[model samples]
Target: MVVQDRRGGGTVAVAMACGTGLAVGLLTSGCSPDGAAADDQEPAGRAAPAAAEVRDSADALVRAGSAAVRTSMETASGGTRVAIRGTGGYDFATSTGRLRVVLPDPAGRPSGGHQPITEILAPGALFMKNRGAGVPADKWVRVATASLADGNLVTGGATDPLAAAELLRGAREVTYQGEEWLDGVRVRHYRGTTDIGAAAAAASPRTAPALAAAGDGFTTGEVPFDAYLDEAGRLRKVRQWFRFANGAPKGASVTSTTELSGFGTKVAVQLPDERDIYAGKIASPTP
Candidate 1:
């Protein structure tokens, strides 16, 4: 019972707008429809905090995470394979920013089939199926824009990086919760609440309909995260869990995994290079 967040819906729009340009690892079928990248784990025994506090924390966390993400659009792998790693810079607008393919279909490899159109989302890049069944090695499509940036000029999403950041900045209260061990790291966790009324006002008079909707805020959406805060109160590693506006049930949770947090760090942005774009040197669809 996962309530797909506006992100999933936004992800689809990205696939449509890019018209199948970049991205990989977007399993159109297997992945959650609402866009919860992975399984939705239910949190336990947590008191609700004031909306203002949570929004402020989220913004602080996003800011601290600036240039901390190993930003890339990659494939799901469980074996020894080389997948195309499309790298990019974070706009922190919370909306997917500029993502370039650092590795295209490796030299003399057919990767079109496995590469589908994806929205270079924050935290990681997402590829949604548009042309082929799943991602095959033969259907890989490259960018043909005059910008020759080898990336899509993406624009869409109920919540953009800037908007999301703003809401997070206004975060008010924080309810101490539990914790989880990811990749062998034990992290502190908590859920922060938000004030939809205030959020809507922050959206401003002429905010885009979509951005406003996200900013217009919800009656109650949970901002769950593991606070790895800096000395200055900036978050270092944040695992964000977003639920429906009213704490209905399970929705989508995007975990922001990172090791550093700061502004103006040496972040990498490039187009997909063939050699580093798919299953261990670009695995061809099984014959």
Candidate 2:
């Protein structure tokens, strides 16, 4: 009987561990409050593109900066992941967000018929549902962090008005490091960072305190990045290195990708509506 009791306890322990892992995975994978990360993963592909525009020392910073923004905003047909590192150190836990926009075609066909576009964000809320109007598909979309928190961090997912008022602008410079293949295609990589304090401060004074808790102190630090583009001149992959703000990379590579090509082809738009939004659950244990 003693041995049986021990065995039962061990089983229960294992079950608990597995359940906890699943929950953590769901949260860390960038699907916590928003429908951003968990579902709709690109069905893995072969590799990233091999032909991205390389940065030369003589390249103009203005154009380079604009290109960096435009390139980062590039979207794939199935979807693109827009992500950035949060430098404002925080105490509770550092956070980042990945917004997936189901790209709609000019024809405005069924949402499911086109590819999707995805963008990752620093810790905060994303309210594209309201501000997306009249915004060109290629135009860089900016939003505020506070507006993103629909009171229900989980159910409301990620959407808030005024989040886009804060936009990301050109960097001082964009220097290409080299090139490598992700998934399979060859891509050009560049590293850079922009001051988060000013950007966040402009958006809200609480930015500093919130970022401090995340370990990315409110002051300023370089936001490391790796951008990959394919032969067709489309951004294929990007890896950001702000651990708290930008989650750690898989390995040596800052970001990774396995697929490329086509959008608006079998895409679908089924975003959760605002009424379905909420900051916390009815029966909640979240903080």
lDDT string for model 1 (69-161, tens) is 332222211211222333334544343344333333323132432342333443223332222324354333332321211112111111223
Q: Give, for candidate 1, the lowest lDDT window spanning 10 residues.
A: 149-158
Q: TM-score winner among the candidates? A: 1
Query: How much lDDT does each candidate structure score?
Result: 0.33, 0.27
Cα RMSD of predicted structure 1: 12.5
Clashes of 1: 62
Model 2's alpha-carbon lDDT is: 0.27
10 residues in a row with least lDDT, candidate 2: 13-22
Candidate 1: Cα lDDT at 182? 38
Candidate 1 local distance difference test against the native: 0.33
Candidate No. with top lDDT:
1
- The digit string of per-residue lDDT tens for model 2 on 1-287 reads 00001222221100001101101111122311111212222224625211113221112111122111111111111122222111111111112333443322323222334334343333443333221223333333333334321111111212111121111112223344566776566765544443334334433332333322222421124334344445443444443322122122421111211122231222222334445333321221222
TM-score of each: 0.38, 0.33
lDDT of 1 at 198: 49
